[model samples]
Target: MQNRRLFLGSVAATAAVAGLSACTSMGGFSLTEAVRRLLQLSANRAFDRLLQPEGFWDDQVTRLALPDMVGNGRGDVLARILTGPMFKDRLAHAFNRTAARAARNAAPAVAEAVRGIGIRNALALLHGRPDEATTYLRGEMAGRLIDVMLPEFGDALHTASDPLIGEVMAALTGVNTAALANDLAVKADDAIWRAIGQEEAAIRADPRSTNDPVLIGALSVR
Candidate 1:
């Protein structure tokens, strides 16, 4: 079942690029191609900017720590013992490093979704408010990304050198491997969304960006 899902995810990604090829072959800037380019651009930009150890960790907004168990009995006690931000910072760094590594695998899934945009949808998006693309992407891609991220998160967690963090959490909060895996996957997804949103904002701000083929095609849709 897992293998099937992963296979399907890869297929979706391939399909996205296929859509791009098909549109490009049509020879003129069409709305579909525009949307494809925008989505592809956004995804590539996000990965490049946010899916690196330095990139992911440097962005204070996306760098996340383990959940604070401030009032949860033994969990709280352990949290206190963990104390200083350095340990948490190290843990966050490791978590982000894992996410960065796994993000490379998400390209296919992202591309597949870009292909899913319809002409009508593209027109709407072209005319919509500034952040519409980002919002649409979040809606369309989050669940798929979660499915894609889980296995990577699990593998990273297993290989990550954080025995003390894991030991404390397991001893105090009874967080087994599966729970940790899910948490990490969710965090990675959130980070991706944030990165995409940031890129979208940049796209909106650049007036010179109007010359981009995707933007040109999108605007011509009407």
Candidate 2:
């Protein structure tokens, strides 16, 4: 009776070990899947925000107010004449309103790209430095968006019945579109850096995980 009981106990222990191994393997797979989903979701969210009006305006961090190209103060004067004493305020508000509407209009294309790109590359980006992911996604999508938005924006600007608004856009026309776009791009980049700094600080303050080794290594190299 004793020997028989021993054999049964051994058998039970072996079965338990096998079950544990399977569970561990499954857990690892789940973690990988979760990481992938997070990346896709985060990337999509960032891109969608970029094309949104709030993304362009409400966030003073990413607002697209261009400097007066006509001259310092002169641009302000021009804005006033065209838009009235409230010209600067109105122009800024209109730019934000229009950009937000336009972003909503461009959302479909952003969605399509998220679905089409496999999750691996984007996941790697999320694990990377702060703006790395944004830069990659922007590079992938911006050209296509520009192709669509430029003509639409131009048409909208042209049809703007407000003479003051028309004059401001006309002044902008004399400047190179590429230069203006670059200025906007720089501001966006600055915003990303600010975000990254905030995120890094939050991570460091927590008593939980250590700083990301990968990010640490990259910073050392830099």
Candidate 3:
């Protein structure tokens, strides 16, 4: 799952180039188009990675593990248990297995929704503020994602067969969902600035990239 996020980030970065090109040609780009392109790029990369043998299982980053209860300041309950014998490995393995399965199940819907984002909101997003664009996409699709993914994750958890493992998975799911949401918020802000900063820097550096719609739109914001 971590790997999935990483892969998504990378793809978004890559997509920025294509988006810039598209925006340049279009005279003005839509934030929706930018995000849709990001999603499309990310999904393609994720699908490629997942098709690999070690895709979800062998990748250390994607391979799930117990939440770091210590650094995260959760409490001693998890620490005490982790320090104890027997259950630690079991707990870790169970969570990873569940997360891997959930990623597999959730991939399709995510891809579909991302594509939908391309078609539905790309134009509107391009015209909106950075945070507004992010909020729009999240509001439009988060509930749909939760509805689709939660059930799949729940099913995967149910099949785990270990009661303790299930408990850990439940905890992990809650943690991951919150983390993902927070991360997206940060990414949205970062992406906004990145888009603006990069464009400004390019204009200063090359002078030819000036007058582009993306740059114009961003500059118009404030």
Alpha-carbon TM-score of each model against the true structure: 0.72, 0.52, 0.41
**Local lDDT at 175 for model 1:** 43
Report every candidate's CA lDDT.
0.66, 0.48, 0.46
Task: Itemize residue pairs with steric clashes in candidate 3.
Answer: 30-126, 31-125, 31-126, 32-122, 32-125, 32-126, 33-122
Tens digit of per-residue lDDT, candidate 3, span 173-210: 33564444233333222322233333323333432344
For candidate 3, the lDDT comes to 0.46
In terms of TM-score, how similar is model 3 to the real structure?
0.41
lDDT of 1 by residue, 1-222 (tens): 999999998897666445444666235555556666766776778888766667678887677557543223275556664577776566666677777776777767787787775445665665566667767876866577878878987775565456654545455555466667777778777888777767666665662474685564344333
* Selected candidate, larger TM-score, 2 vs 3: 2
Give the candidates in order of TM-score, highest first.
Answer: 1, 2, 3
Poorest 10 consecutive residues by lDDT, candidate 2: 213-222
Of the candidates shown, which would achieve the greatest TM-score relative to the real structure? 1
User: Residue 3's C-alpha lDDT in candidate 1?
Assistant: 100
Rank list by lDDT: 1, 2, 3
Best by lDDT: 1
